[model samples]
Target: MSAFLADRDSARFELRFQSLFNAGHVVSFPCNAAGQVDLDALSERERDRYLYARAVVGGVFSLPQKQRRLD
Candidate 1:
């Protein structure tokens, strides 16, 4: 239940991320310890996509929880 929805959400987020990544809006997706995007490393446009992806992923996306939280 939750897992499936989570997977779906992740897929959607990945799609959105890829769209911007391919569009050259994001150079790299350097995440913090908690796996969220490291805004310090991202430009304003990249940051927007990152935040959008975060929302699409239901705010549960990260690089494996090994990175620190972005905010």
Candidate 2:
């Protein structure tokens, strides 16, 4: 029971995440100092990685943790 319950805590976070805000602001599609992407650096493999992951917007999160401890 201890092993199963303890391990399940980490299982709750199987999803991986990446924040593009800083990167998106720094890079661009046509490769500019402040407003474009570096086509040369965009790998097909990297694009596929994004396609597989979930997309989030406005710094939102699902299921806020219970604030009050259960009795």
Candidate 3:
């Protein structure tokens, strides 16, 4: 029983970690090598979206993994 519970818990933890890693990849794809958006190259609307993404990604990665959340 304990072994089964441990296995299930490990699976859940790995799933969560994979999701976060995938999200990091996605958020990373949009930015340049320096991890910054090129505001001048973007349209006004795109600039807004880029800025928002930057802030959200920055905050998420800045916090401890346990405390990371979009909210």
* Model 1 residue 41 distance off true place after TM-score fit, in angstroms: 2.4
Worst 10 residues of 2 by lDDT: 26-35
Error of 3 at 4 (Å): 56
Taking the tens digit of each residue's C-alpha lDDT, what string does model 1 give over 1-71?
23333332222222223333233432225543234443554578878866665565423333222322233
Better of 2 and 3 by TM-score: 3
Between candidates 2 and 3, which one is better according to lDDT? 3
Residue 58 Cα positional deviation in candidate 1, in Å, after optimal superposition: 5.4
Candidate 3 local lDDT, 2-67, one digit each (tens): 333333322222101112344554322222322333355557886675455545654443321221
Clash number for candidate 3: 0
Over 4 Å off in model 2, which ranges?
Answer: 1-31, 49-55, 59-71
Which residue pairs clash within candidate 3?
Answer: none
Clash pairs detected, candidate 1? 32-67, 32-68, 33-67, 33-68, 34-67, 34-68, 35-63
RMSD values, in order shown: 12.9, 16.6, 16.0
